[model samples]
Target chain A: MMPIAITDPDDPRIEPYRAVRERDLVGRQHRFIVEGEVVLRVLLQQSRFDIESLLLAENRIDSLSNALENLPPNVPVYTANRQVMDAIVGFPIHRGILAMARRAPLPPVEDFLATLPQEALIVGLVGLANHDNVGGIFRNAAAFGAQGILLDQESCDPLYRKAVRVSVGGALIVPFTRVASANAMVRALQGASFEILAFSPAGQEILSQVKPARRTALLLGAEGPGLPPDLLAQTRTVSIPMSGGFDSLNVATTSGIALHHLKSQRS
Target chain B: MMPIAITDPDDPRIEPYRAVRERDLVGRQHRFIVEGEVVLRVLLQQSRFDIESLLLAENRIDSLSNALENLPPNVPVYTANRQVMDAIVGFPIHRGILAMARRAPLPPVEDFLATLPQEALIVGLVGLANHDNVGGIFRNAAAFGAQGILLDQESCDPLYRKAVRVSVGGALIVPFTRVASANAMVRALQGASFEILAFSPAGQEILSQVKPARRTALLLGAEGPGLPPDLLAQTRTVSIPMSGGFDSLNVATTSGIALHHLKSQRS
Candidate 1:
C-alpha cells in the first residue's frame, strides 16, 4: 500500500473521505461511505468492489499497518493527524480507519433471479428508511440463506456507512438489487413464477401455517405504518402468531424471525 | 397540571432531571428519562409508574397544552426556552418534550414465577450490553407470549433512554426482573421446575426437532460471542435451523423466532 501524508483537512485528494452527512450520501455521484476496520476488511476481501482509497490517523497507522499490508501495492493509503481527521470526518470518534469504495454494480433483476435455485427465499424491502434496520435485515437475510435482498427506490441506501457498520459487514456479502417500484418488482417476480408473501401484523393466515412454495418472496415494510393496502393487495399476506397483549416486533427482528421460519420449513 | 417557569438549568427543584448522564440508573433513585411525545403518551397511560415531572419547550407549549390538560392537576410541568433546555439536557436538539418518571418496582422472582402458567416460554438475558437489542428482545418476548424476562445484573439496564425508546414503550409493560447472576438464575429456574434452554448455533437439535416442554426458559447472550459455555452446559442447547451458507441470526431476532416456534408448538 502506498502511504500519502495529508496535513490539512481541506486537501482536495481527501474529498472522498469528507464527512458524510445525510445529503452527501444521497447524491448520484457519491453513493455511500464505509467506516471502521471490520467493514473495510470485508470490502477488501470481496473481489466485487473497487476500493477508491484508505484514510487513517497517523497514530493508528502502526496498529493497522499489518492489515494495510494485505491491500494491493497500488492502493493509496492517506494519513492525517487526529485533529485533521476528526475535522474532516465531522464525527470525533470513528474506529480510526475509513475507506472509500465504489458501490459494486448490482446484477440485473432478471439475470439475478435466473441464477437462484428452484426454491428461493427473497426478502424485499419496501419504503423502509432506517439504515440500521435495513442493515439488520440484510444480515438476517444472509444468515437464513435468502436468495437476495430487493430494495425499492425510496428505501434508504443499504450501503450507507452506518448500515455497513451495524450489519457487521454482512452488507458486503449479501447479494442485493434496487427495484424502481414495489408494484413493478412484484409483477416481475410473479412473472418469474415466484410466490410473493407480504408479512403483515393483521394478516389472515398464521406464518407457520403457510406451506413453503417453490420460489418465495417475503415482503417487509417499515416499522410504524406497515405495507400499504395497495401493496398488500398485490401479494398474499401472512402473519406471525404472537401472544395476546403484544402488537408487533421490530421490522428487522420480524424479518429475521420470518426468514428463519421460512428457511426451516422449506429445508 | 401545575406549570413551573424555569430560567435556570441548575434549579434545585428540577435536580431529578438534571445531569442524567452522570447519574447511575441501576439503583432505585433514578428513573429513565423518556423523550418525544409518542413515548411519553404511552408511559402516561401506564398506571404503575409515578410521573416525576414534564418539561416542554416554550414553542411547543401551545400545541401540548391541551394534552397536558389531561394530566393530573398536581403534576408539575416545566416550561423553558430552547437554549435553557439545551443547557440542562446536555444535547442541543431537544425533542420538544421530556418526562422523568419513577421506575416501577419489580416483583420478586418467586412471585413472578407464581404468576406464570405451567406451560410458559420465558426469555432470559445474560450479559447482553446493547440497549437496542435488549429493548428489541423485550418487544419480541412480549409479542411471542413469553411469560417474562430474566436479566442478569451485568446486562444493560432496560429502563435506559435508548432501550425504552427502541422498545416503543414495551419495556414499561413487559414483566422483567434482574437476577444476581446467570448461574443463580438458572438454578432458581431449575428449582422452580422449569426447563432451561440456551440458544447456540452449534446445538445438536434444531428448534423444530426439539420437543416442546410445558415450561421452558430460553437463555440468550450478547451478539458475536453467544451464550457462554458454562451457561450452555447447564441448560439444553437448541439451534434455529438455517440454510447451508448462513451462520447465525441477530440475538434479538433469534429470540423472537425461537419464542414463536416454542409458542406455536404449545398452541
Candidate 2:
C-alpha cells in the first residue's frame, strides 16, 4: 500500500486520531489505538487484531520501512509532519507511530477454557481497575508462558492504550477474555479440571510449597481489599511469605512472582 | 499534638505545601512529602525519618485521629478546609493527607554494607531512573525479606513522592543508600562477602536452578539497556527463563520474582 500524505490535522481520513487524549477517556467505537514504535511493530507482526490503519510522522517512515513492507496490502498508511501529527494527537509525537486496530468478539469463559492445552497455566484477575497493573500482569503472563488470562468484569480493559504500552505488546500477544464475575471464572476453570490457587495475604498455604496440578489457574485481586473473603473461603489460597510487617506488594508485581513460581515448577 | 486550623492558603506557616507540582519539579529543600492515609500511617509508626510537620484537610482529621494520636509530641499538624487545602496544594486534596519529613545523611556505601546480617538478601539497582519501577522494586525488596538496597547514582530516588506512594511505605521501611556507580556497588557488595548476581537475558544460570549464597545481592539494571556488559561480566549472572519470542518483564517485576526465588531457596 502507498503512504497517503495528510497535510491537515482536521482531515476526515484521520478523524480517529483527533484529540487522542479525549478519545481515550471515551470509548473508541470498538477500536483501540496502539502507540509508540515497539507496540506498533508488535501489532503489525503478530497481534490477533485486524489493522484498521496506520498513522506515522513522515520522518519515522524510513526507520519503520522494514516493518511497513510487511503490512497487509489493504491497510492504509497515513503520514504527517511533526506539527500536523502533534495537532492530530493533541500531544507531541515523540515515538511517532500509532495504529488503529479492532478485535473480534472474545470467546465465552467456558469455551475459552475448553480450548486450552491439556496441561496449561493461566492467570485470573479480580477487581483490578488499575491499567498499569493489568498491563504488567499481561507482560508477566507472556514472559512466563501463562497461555491465557481471565479478568473478571470489574477489571479494566487490557486494550486500553496505557495498559498495552506497559505490557510492551504482551497485551496483543496473550489471549484474554472477561468473565461475568469472579465466581463464574472460578467455576469455569474448575469445570475445565484446572486447580485454582487464589493469592491473598491470609492464604492457607505458602506459595513456595503449594504443588500445583497439571492445569493451574493462579488468581489475584486488587492491592488492598485483596481477593474477597467469600472468594478466599471458596478457593485453596496461597500467600507469599512477607517480612517486616509488609503485606503489600503491587498487584502486578505479585502476579509476576506468582506466574514465575507456578510456571517454572509446573510438572 | 493539637491540630492547628489555617484559614488562608498562603499562610506563612503552610508555605511548604504551596504549588506542590512545581515544588516537585524543583527540589523540596532537604525534605520529602508523604501523601495519603496508608503511607501516613506507615510514616508515623515506623519510618526512620524525623517528621517535620503534616498538612491535612480539616474534615480528614477525625478519620486520622488514631494515627495522629501516635505522632511525636513536637511535630505540628496543620489542618485546612477543602478550598484552602486545594489552593495551597495547587490541586484537589483527594487523598486529604500529606506529611513533610527529613532524613539524616545516608551512610557511605561501605559503611552501609558493614551493617547487614550474615545471612542477608539485598537488591542492587543500576540506571533504573523510572520512579514507579524504583518504588515497585523497593516494595518487592521489603516483601521478600530483602533487608537493604543499593542503587547506582543513575537510579531515581525511591523517596520521590510518586515512588514512595507506589512503594506503599516500603520506601520508608527498607534501608537504602545510593553509590557512585554500578561498579563501585558491586565492589562493595563483594567486599562484604555478597555473591552479586546480575540479572540479564543472556545470563549464565537460570534463576530457579541457581543456588544463592548466604549473603546474596540480586543486581538489576534498567529495562531496555539491562546491565552494562562489563558489569554483567564481572558479576555472577542469572536469568529468569522466559518463553516464546518475549524477553521483557518490567524491571520492578523482575526484582520481585528474583527476590522471592533467592530468598525462599536460600541455604
Candidate 3:
C-alpha cells in the first residue's frame, strides 16, 4: 500500500485531521479520531469500525511498512512532514500517527445484552462524564476479560481522542454501548439474569464480603456524587472500606479492583 | 483573618505563584505548589508541610471564610482579580486557589520503615515517570490503607502539580519517600522483613494463589517495559491471570487492586 503524499496542511483529502482540539466529537456521532501507532494498530484489527484514512509523518511511512501491508488497500494512507503534521492537528502530535475511523451504529441496550454469555461479567458506568474515567474503565474491563461494558447517557464517549490514548487502546477492543440511565442499565442487566451490584463509599458491605453471583454486573458512579441512593437501594451495595477514611479511589481504579475480584478471584 | 489585597499581578510577594508550568519545580526541592481549593484545604491540614502563603482569586475569598479561620495568624493570604490571577499562572486558574507549601526533608527509607507497625502493606513504584500514575497510585494507596509508598528515583515527584491534582490531594495525606533504584527499593523493603512480591505479566503464579505475609510490599513497574528480569528473579513473582491474554492493567489500577487484596482480604 503506497502512501499518498500530502504537501499542504489544508489538503482537502486530509481535512479530518484539522484543528482536532476545538472540535467536539460528541456531535460527530459516526466518526472518531485515534492517535499514535499503538492505538492505530488496535483500530485496524477491530471489526466494528472502518478505517476511513490514516495520516502519518513522512519519516514514519518507511517504518510502518509492515503494518501498512495488513491494512485494507482501499484505505487512504496520507504522509505529511513535521510542519504539515503539526499544522493539521493544531499541536505537536507525538507519535506522528493518526487515523480517522468510522463507527457503525451501536446495537440498542437490550439487543447488546442478549449477545453476552450467561456467565458474563460486565461493568456499568453511570453519570461518568469524564473521558479519562470512561477510557480507564474499558482498559480495566479488557484486562479482566469483561464480556462488555454498559454506559449511561451522561457518560462521555469512550472514543474521544484523549480517552482512547489514556486507555492505551483498550477503548478500541473492549465491546461497549450506551443505555438511557443507571436505572435502565440495571433493569436490562436484571432481565438478562445478571446480579446488579452497585458500589459506593457509603455502602454497608465491604468489597471482599460480597459474593459475585454466576453472572454479575458491577455498577459504579462518578467520583464526587457517588452511585445514586435510590439506585443503590435497588441493588446489593458494596464498598471498598476505606482504612484511614480516605475519600475514595479514582473511578477507573475502582473498576479495576472490582473487576479483578469478580473475574480473577472467582476463576 | 482579613485577606491581603494584591492589585498588581507583578507583586513580589506573590512571586511564588507565577508561571508555575514554566518554572523548574524539580530544582526547587523543598517547596511544592498545590492548586485548586480541594487540594489547598488538604495542604493546610497536613503537618508534613509548612504553609508558606496562599494566593487566591478575589471572588473566592469571601466563600472560603470558614476555612480561612483555621489557618495560623502568620500565614499571609493574597487576593487578586481574575485578570491578575491568569497573568500570574499563564492560564485560566480555576477555583482561584493556590498554595506554596514547604516540605520538611524526608527521612531515610530505612528510617521511615522502622517507624511502621509490625504488619504493613506498602506499594513500591519503579520507573513510573508519568505524574498522573504517581498521583493515582497515592490515591489508591490511601484508599486501601497502605502504610507507605516507596518510589524509585526514576519516578516523577508525587508533589508535581498535575499529580497532586489528579490524586485529589492523596499525595498530601499518604506518607511516601524515594530511593535510588528499583533494586534498592526491593532490598530496603526486604531488609525490613517485608515479603517482596514483584508484579509482572510474565510471572508464573496467579495473584489469588499467592499468600500475603505479616509484612508485604507490592512492587510495580511502568506499563510497557515492566519490572526488569533481574528484579523479578529477586522477588516472588505473582501475576494477575488474564483470561483473554490482554495487555496488563494500568500501573495505578494494578496498585489499587493489589493493595486492596493485601489490606482488606486479611481483615
Candidate 3, superposed: residue stretches over 4 Å from native: B24-26, B243-245
What order do you get sorting by TM-score, best first?
2, 3, 1
Q: Model 3: per-residue lDDT, tens digit, A99-145?
A: 99897677898999899888888889999999889989988887787
Candidates 2 and 3, the one with greater DockQ? 2
Alpha-carbon shift of residue A223 in model 2 (angstroms):
1.6
For model 2, residues B117-152, the per-residue Cα lDDT tens digits are: 998889999999999999988888878778799988
Candidate 2 structure quality by residue, lDDT tens digits, A118-169:
9899999999999989999998888887889999989998998999999999
For candidate 3, the TM-score of chain A alone versus the native chain A is: 0.95
Native-to-model Cα distance after best TM-score fit, residue A257 in candidate 2, in Å: 0.4
Tens-digit lDDT track for model 1 on A1-267? 557999888999988767657435565354456777767766777424677788888777787776776787777889888888988878784577887777877777777788888978888889999988998887787677677888888788778777877776678777888888888778778877899889899887788788878899989999778888898886799988775645578888888778877877876
Fnat measured on candidate 1: 0.81
What proportion of true contacts does candidate 3 retain? 0.85
Best by TM-score: 2
lDDT against the true structure, per candidate, is 0.79, 0.89, 0.84
Where does candidate 2 stray beyond 4 Å?
A: none
Q: If the candidates were sorted by their DockQ against the true structure, best first, what order would they fall in?
A: 2, 3, 1
Better of 1 and 3 by lDDT: 3
Provide TM-scores for the models: 0.86, 0.97, 0.94
Better of 1 and 2 by DockQ: 2
